[model samples]
Target: MQPDLTVSRTYSGPICLQDPIDKELMTESSLFNPLTDIKVKVQSSFMVSLGVTERSEYHGKAHSGTFPHDSNRTFNPIHAKNKAAYLQNLSSLTKRSDMRTTGVFGHLGGRLGIPNTGVSLLIPHGAFSEEASWEIYLAINQSEPSLQLEGSEILLGPEVTCGPPEVTVSTPFALTIPHCAEVNPDHWTIHLKKKKEQGKWEEVMSVEEETTSCYCLLDPYACHILLDSFGTYALVGEPLSDCSVKELKVAVFGCMSCNSLDYSLRVYCVDNTPWAFQEVILDEKHQGGRLLEEPKLLHFKGSTFSLQISVLDIPPFLWRIKPFTACQEVPFSRVWRSNQQPLHCAFSLERYTPSTTQLSCKICVRQVKGHEQILHIQTSILENERDTITFFAHDDSHFPAQMGPQAFKIPYSIRQRICATFDTPSAKGKDWQMLAQKNSINRNLTYFATQRSPSAVILDLWEARHQHDGDLDSLACALEEIGRTQAHISALAETQTEESHFSYSRQNGL
Candidate 1:
């Protein structure tokens, strides 16, 4: 009566296709499909759920904005799940001295930074939901051979990582990274690269290109990025022409050879990164070489040019250079690759007579077809009177001490408050410059200006200069001279309070 019907059903399991039926079998079976006999069934109550429905609904109800929807963007769920492990592996491979971590609330937001490293991250007030909180970390790669540069490609900054990549942010965040390359759009092509889940680096965007996912604002000393993702990032430069330039810190270190009469001078040309310079300083200390002068910045261009170093104005009658040629040349690759270690040109000089206790000469450093720097060196070769004065000035018990913010007589909190108060420029002569002058940091104003906080750097210099025998009264007096009596008084009170607490604790043996 219903005309025997053949039914075809689809299942959610593996699908299989069968071969065409034979002509004889088709004819033997009843013809089931007539336009009128076939019936289709539809379920109106069924619903389909996409994976993003929960997130979408939550975002709509909890926040004023929604996540970006780009059909072209592909996200790997597996990668997101394993991101923490990947970051941990990276952290384990590099030194953690420069790493900084902070807890951030979703509703309040917060900032994290590595002090004096020129690296910071700023999260907006509503980057996450009210219930969300995260432990954010920022670190710079400090291990030797941490990164490899390709042909003609130069690393402009340290390899930096901001992680716990599993955490999601609803809004874009700001990241500031410092670079050593001189900004010249015409001669250099700069781009930001991110490490992919597979351990390969992928270019995120060119600083010169226009994009909606991220924006880049280049400053003289740092690069500011507005990005929505968290990962490891680095700034890379490709020299478009020979005119492209990189900034290097040139330092000269010298020591009396074992022979006493023979003096050795070591000239170093390294990337201008602060960490790189600090490494050279540590090495020099181990080798007993004194810094000849304040380090100077050298603009090294992309041209494949060698560096030439020679001693000029040497009293010919008093000293003679040991080399066949007074001037020595260093290859371009050698200096460029000095980021990982200390590379220098050694010059040996012999004094004609031991009576020549004082050495005075001009050391000339020049880049072929580039800039040149002249350093005046005058010191007592035998007695080291300058070092002796410094040594005696400080307590010899702490002879090998490293000076830092902790060494300052001022409490860290008060110093921070002072920096925040005075870092702002004013019409009246009451800014960081005045503060520096008050503290006797009168030179290298240009260098200080290039830092993120000029006042903080000035204080660091003051600490280094007066680590020993530095009194809180002197600093308080200086602050008072600058019309900051309130801050000055507060600093003195806090120091006295801290000292009293320490004494009480010692008496109780706590």
Candidate 2:
């Protein structure tokens, strides 16, 4: 079929375009002016960002004493970025005053998407977080026709050069055809025929390149086109309705900014969902990973920053997982674990040479949405301990012996000195003889060892070293509680490292 022969210039008529805004309505009767006045208390701890969806559900303990309970649910996607309130109870843009409780009430809860409207009450955090709603992210879809201001081939004076209007660019940069002439697909190209030659312009000479426009950038959203001046300037936001570039100069922008993305992240423990963490912290109005929670700073000024923590060979310490305890070896896990009968990867850090377990990870991120996925390949440290413990976990019940609204949980597994203790043989000899028997027993450094629990003491050594009678034996305990774990292999302090990466598929038994 032949194309429509009839065509008109920009600014010559009007063209319809889609609106960029979305809207919704709410009832005021039930929310704005309730028949009875009421007040319900709400307390929030920290707020976390889940994925880019508007859901209102999360796990939380109930006031009525409930164990491992949760109310995971999805709510309508509402834009909660700086909206105003409309009621007392229904405290939202479209409020009815009649208060009703749903998801996270005593904590943080809300949906995602559209702008949020209401008196969002946030408790204090650090010194500044209380006032900030969110890090700003703007999606720009500047195209043609939308910002079209009539006309074509904008006639600038002899000295005026066209390019990006308000951008901070240096050399070799381009933008769309804006504030100048508008060109659309119907008119094809904006032919820039030099009118009068200052001096017969050479076909491929520098002067010829200065007056001819070559690069064009089309904005599909706004229906605008960008043009580069000769080879120096880039102008954008032109109404493609006009055909004015019959003479003079023109070009196009490479349209390179096709994949810029802005993102925000709400962190979560591996298997645990994300939003619940946010509500628990933000809703409780607690501090330090709790109410009034502070978001972890990930990337700043092109540099990434974050604290990577590993719960070492923590025993199945369930009691150490309390929310308000610190300064102790608590229970923990190494994978996406559930709240019930979760197992931890145990390990004797001393047995493994830095050869099997890979604690180091490389995060691969896609440029489009800035979405990142972490790649975990075992390092060389998890070797040798093949017959023993591997990963680490903190016991859950290790709640601290203190209590308060602002208590902090700082867990640490100290690597004390290595020591040895001997198991007293069932000796029924004289007191002196029993003592001598203990002394004569052996305690070897190279052999395996274990510590007695009730009055923890070192055990296991060679027999020859067992000399003096029991009480006055030689040094049997560890001389140093050295930090000999797989984590040390990944620490940045290594000035010189062995040049080998052990892979599972390698034949050398790495």
lDDT of each: 0.61, 0.19
TM-score, every prediction: 0.55, 0.13
Q: Write the per-residue lDDT of candidate 1 for residues 1-510, one digit (tens) a residue.
A: 111113323223221223221122123323211112112221110000000100111111122212222344333322666767755664564565534443333443545666545566666544666554555667677765334567787778777788666667776666777777889899988999888777788888888776655656666667777667888888888889988888887777888999978988888887776556656766778888887767777888878898888888888889988766578898987766555666678888889888888778888888998999888888777544744312111223222221222223443434554566557775445478888787765544665576567676565444333333434444544554554333355568789999999999999998
Q: Candidate 2 lDDT, tens digit per residue, 176-262?
A: 111212233343233222212232212121111222222122222111111212212212221233232211111000101122221
Off by over 4 Å in 2: 1-13, 16-273, 286-335, 338-510
What's the lDDT for candidate 1? 0.61
Query: How good is model 1 by TM-score?
Result: 0.55
**Residue 479 alpha-carbon offset, candidate 2, angstroms:** 71
How many collisions between residues are there in candidate 2?
119
The regions of model 1 sitting more than 4 angstroms off are 1-93, 96-107, 125-132, 144-151, 336-338, 351-357, 381-384, 387-510
